[model samples]
Each structure stands twice: as C-alpha cells, then as structure tokens.
Target: MKKLMLAAAALALTAGMGLAQDTVRMGTEGAYPPYNFINDQTGEVDGFERELGDELCKRAELTCTWVKNDWDSIIPNLVSSNYDTIMAGMNINEERKKVIQFTQPYTPGLPSAYAALAADADIKGGVVAAQTSTIQASHVAESGATLMEFATPDETVAAVRNGEADAVFADKDYLKPLVEQSNGELVWVDGFDTVKLGEGIGMGLRQSDNELKEKFDAAITAMKEDGSLNEMLKKWFGEDSQLFE
Candidate 1:
C-alpha cells in the first residue's frame, strides 16, 4: 500500500511537470501592478503582461499559461526550465542576454525615475533602494550613492518609507502611479538621468530555444504591423505608450 501511494504521488508530480513543458508557461512576478499584478477580484494574473502574453501566444499558435514567481528567482527559474518564457516587463539588457535570449522589445522607451518620502532629497552619496538584479540597482551601485538592494519592488519602496533609504529607483511609469496613490507619502525626485537602457522590455527565453525565440519575435513583429499591439499598449500603459512601429 505504501509503495503504491508513493508511486502515485511521483506519477502525479511528473505529469504536472510534463504539462507545464508542453504548454508555454508564462512566468511573471504578478506583483508589479499595471505592468503585472494579481487581480484581487479574479484571483488571477491580470495586467499588461497577462494580456500581451495571451495575445502573443494566440498569434504564435501556442498554448500558454501563467506562472507566478518571485522577482529574485525569475531569471534563475527561467534558466532551470521551470517555466518556458519570462514576460515580466524584463528589459532587454546586454547583461541579461548573456544568460538568456529575448524577443523583440514590446514596450516603447520608458525611463527610470526615483521616488521618496521627501518632496526634495539628494540621492548623490546617499542611500538608494532598488530591486536586486535590476538595471536600476546596477546604476545606483556605480553612482556615488550607497546602494541598498531588496528582493522585491515593494520592499525597495518600503525602505524609503522607513527612512532606510533616501529613494527608490524604478520605471517611471510604475513609480508615478505609486507616488500619486501615496497621498503625499511619496514624491518623485530628480536623482538620476533618463538614460536609455537596453532596447526596451522583451520576453525572456532560454538561450538554446531558438525556435521559441523566433516564434515570439515573429508574433511581436506581426502585432507591430497590425494595430492590435498598439491598442494593447494604450489599454495597459495608456496613450503615453507609443506604438513600437
């Protein structure tokens, strides 16, 4: 009886993993709102990535499903084949491409910004918070400021609220909404230059998955040719998000 039970459990686990690999498992943090977040009402992944990924999968004729992962482990899990692709608003930076390949960037140019509790604060030579393994963190580390890395975006923002850090650097589009909702608790500060990082945001895939990469890249291109991609961008990021074409 014990051997039968153990075999059943193992079989179930293997079946589930096989299903994940058969269908394209779209991995995301589902914590970054607007870009990606869990809709409390629906209890599902609902945001730009959710919608965009669904559309891309449809265009590419692939069966895709969402998989939520921690921000810190996002890339590592992708490499380990825990999920098929990463569409977590990940920028197509050279540093990241060394480990994984990326489809054409889906997002238009969006700059990183800083936010803090103070209306005016200097980030120069001061402590700044950023999510670990992000471009923002790398920039802060090289800058004159002391860099404080957090595993999550919320924690990075919390560092500023707790006075542990002077400010948190992140995508302006993501931070702007947070600042507005803070009710005077947080304010945007001029701490960094609006430098272009990478091509833009793209879907991450294992380096060896050239066919998968081609499929997504072609799907993105098709969306660009059609007006559907632009409509999606407007719906999620607002009209401020320009058409990729």
Candidate 2:
C-alpha cells in the first residue's frame, strides 16, 4: 500500500510540473521607460511592467518569458502568434479591443497630451511626433497637426528637442521624465482630458486566448483588492500622480 501511494504521489507531482511548464511568452516594446524599457547598461528589460509581469506570472502559476518588439508591430505579432501575450504598457481602448483581448486594467487612464519647451511660443499647429499606429497619433492628426510618426517614445521626444517636430503627444508619465531631463525644453500643454485619452493600461492577449485572459484578469483584480497594485504605482509614479488618484 505504501509503494502504491508513493507512485500515485509521483504521478501527481509530474502532472503539476507539466502544468507549470506551460510557458507564457509575453512581448513588450522594451523602449518605454518607467514601464518596460531595457536597461541601458545591463541590456536586460526592467521597469514597472517587468516587475508586475513577474508577479502576474507567479499568481497564474505559469512560466513567463519576455520578448522585445517594436511598438508598431506588436499587435500584429501577437495576432500571428509571435508571442502568447503582451505586457507592454498598452492602453485598453475600443479600437484595440476590436483586434485583441486585454486583461483588466492594471494602471488607470491618465491623460496624454502635447508638451514643448517651456520657453517656446505656444504651438501654432505644425508637425507633431507620436508613436506610429497609436491613438495619440490619431488624435494628433484629428487636431490638424501634421503627423510625424516615430517608432518609440524617446524618438518622439528627440524630434521635439531637435526642432524636427513642434511638439509630442504621449502619456503623461513618459512625458514627465523627458520634461525634467530636457532641462526646460519640454512642458506639458494645458487642456488635455483623460476621457479623450481613452482607457488605462492593460495586458494584451490573443483574442482567442480566453483562458489566459481570464487568469490574468483575475490576478490583476486580486492585486487591486489587496493593495499590491497601488503600492507598485506609488513606487514608480509618486503618490500624487494620477495613477494613484
């Protein structure tokens, strides 16, 4: 009887290991700092999203691996099975929802808007740079600014600083660091609204991966309930940032 019981336990352990080994391949731009950018020196991805993705993987009992991809091709790569999920700081919006599934938002919606040199004259409707294929680009075009699209957030900021673009439209968090680093070359414009900015950031998944989506959604919900999510937001974005408010 003892031997039989031992054999049964071994089988169960093997089954559990098999389940745990079902790897989840997650993708990120790895260029959006404070969220999921690659470390300049170490060359490894690190940021709030990297940490949060680790926690979510733990909660879901799945092995997770991250891959870096260009922002413009992220969604298409997901659709083509280049990865099992996307944990980049992707905003949940209707247009994105139409193409792929998203986990419940981990970060709340904060307004994205134009920012320019603090001393520069007010924007008079010239070329503006935004991440290509993003909602910000759509809004910029709608506002009658000629679109100068870029592949990453840093590039957009560079465009503004180099005088190649008049302004940049991007998330407040991303813009904040640039404004500080630019030595007064960038300042947020007034009158941006969160509502028009769309929804908060969430994880992206293949539209057909309902089971994985459900797991991620539940994990995020638990984090929110237990205050873990708020703690993370505070650590990265400060207490007064809209993410906490």
Candidate 3:
C-alpha cells in the first residue's frame, strides 16, 4: 500500500509540472497605449506590452497568448484563473502584494501626471477624473479634489475635454502623446507635480504560481541585461523614459 501511494504521488507531481509548462495566457487591457492596445490596423494586441510580452515568452520558452480584460477586473480575473498573468501596466505595491505575486519590475517607476485643457486648471480643488480602482483615483480622492471615476482611461480624458472635469490624472507616458497630438487643445496642468506611486510596473501572477513568476522574472532580467528592455522602452515611451541602469 505504501509503494502504491508513492507511485500515485509521483504521477500527480509529474502532471502538475506538465500543466505548469502549458500555454500561458497573458491578460492585458487592450486600451492603454505605449503599454498595450488593440492596433486598429491589425485588429490585434499591439504596442509595448505586446512586443515585450512576446519576447519574454520566447525567452522563457513558454507558449503564450494574449487575453484582453477590462482594467477594473484585471486583477480579480487573474486571481480567479481567467488568465495566467497580468501585463496590463499594473504597478507593484504592498496592497496588491497581499493578493498576488509580482515579477521584478520590468520598468522603473514612471510618473503620473495631470492633463487639462488649460495650464491654470484647478487640480487640487476642482474635479479630477481618473480611471476607477487606479492609483490615480486614490491619489485624487486623498488630494482634496472631487474625484470622478471612469470605467476606462479614455473616459477620464474625455471628461476633461467635455467640461465634466477640470483635469485628468494618468501615467505620464500614456498622456504624453495625447497632449502632443491635441493640437495645443490639451496641455499638462502647470504647477501640478508629477507623482510616482507604487514601486514600478511588473507582471502580476497568482500567489500560488511561483514557478510561472520565476520564469518571467528570469526573462525580464535577461532583457534588462541585454539592453533590449531599454531599447523597447524608448521605442514605445520615448527617449526620456527611465531605464534599468
């Protein structure tokens, strides 16, 4: 009976290992750009995360596929096993660490900035729009501003353009191109200092999936060491983006 039990346990362990090597579903919000977004031209996931994720999978020798999830439910879905990993520009922080594990940061801490129609727009006392469940929303709530939460990042920007809010707070990387392309209609809010919240952006995995997390962490490190990661950052986020070195 003892010998039979050992054989069964060994078989179960092998099966678990095989399952771990199976296709990794990478979850992302196909909206945020310079990070991840649906390329209208390809009708598929594109942008920085898409490129970086594919390369990481290649280095990790993991078969992976992209899965789109709304930003608000990204973490919940990840924990529920709707996907194997989150590459949705999620920041690594203590609050999130309680529920999930994070791979070492892939990017340095990026600044969050406020955008508005006018440089003089009131950000501290007037209404500020931010995506729901985001660090920006939490910051706005605590900064004595009236916080208006939206379901998507685009909605937050729309709130500013539509006169619904005085300003929108979001990642500076994500907001830079928008301000430049706005034909001077939109500009960075003057006197509003950009803030870096959390540690940095990292891939989120389930607390139980240490093996998978290790694979990604190793891949990220390799990229950083090879300088491929820095090149990609500059390509997507412009030359001014922070580098690993």
Best by lDDT: 3
The alpha-carbon lDDT assigned to residue 140 of candidate 1 equals 88
TM-score of each: 0.88, 0.87, 0.92
Candidate 3 residue lDDT tens string, 1-245: 99999999999999999876678999999999989999999899998999999999999998899999999999999999999999988888888899999999999998899999999999989999999988888889999999999989999999999999999999888898899999999998886647789899999999999999889999999999999999999898878878989
Sort by lDDT, best first: what order?
A: 3, 1, 2
| Model 3 stretches with alpha carbons more than 4 Å out | 1-20
Q: Given candidate 3, what's the lDDT at residue 90?
A: 85
Error of 1 at 11 (Å): 22
Model 3, poorest ten-residue lDDT window? Answer: 189-198
Cα displacement (angstroms), candidate 3, residue 56, comes to 0.8
Tell me the tens digit of each residue's lDDT in model 2 across 1-245: 99999999999999988775478888999988789899989998899999999998899888898899999999999999989888877888899999998988889886676787544434447788899988888888897778899988889989888989877888878777777777766777655423247788989998899999988999898888888989998888888765533
Worst 10 residues of 1 by lDDT: 190-199
For model 2, the local distance difference test gives 0.83
Instruction: Compute the lDDT for candidate 1.
Output: 0.87
Model 1 lDDT tens row, 1-245: 99999999999999999765558999999988788999999999999989999989998888898899999999999999899999887888889989999898888766888888875776877899999988888988888999999988889998999999998988877887889899989997854535566578999999999988999999999998987888988887778765676
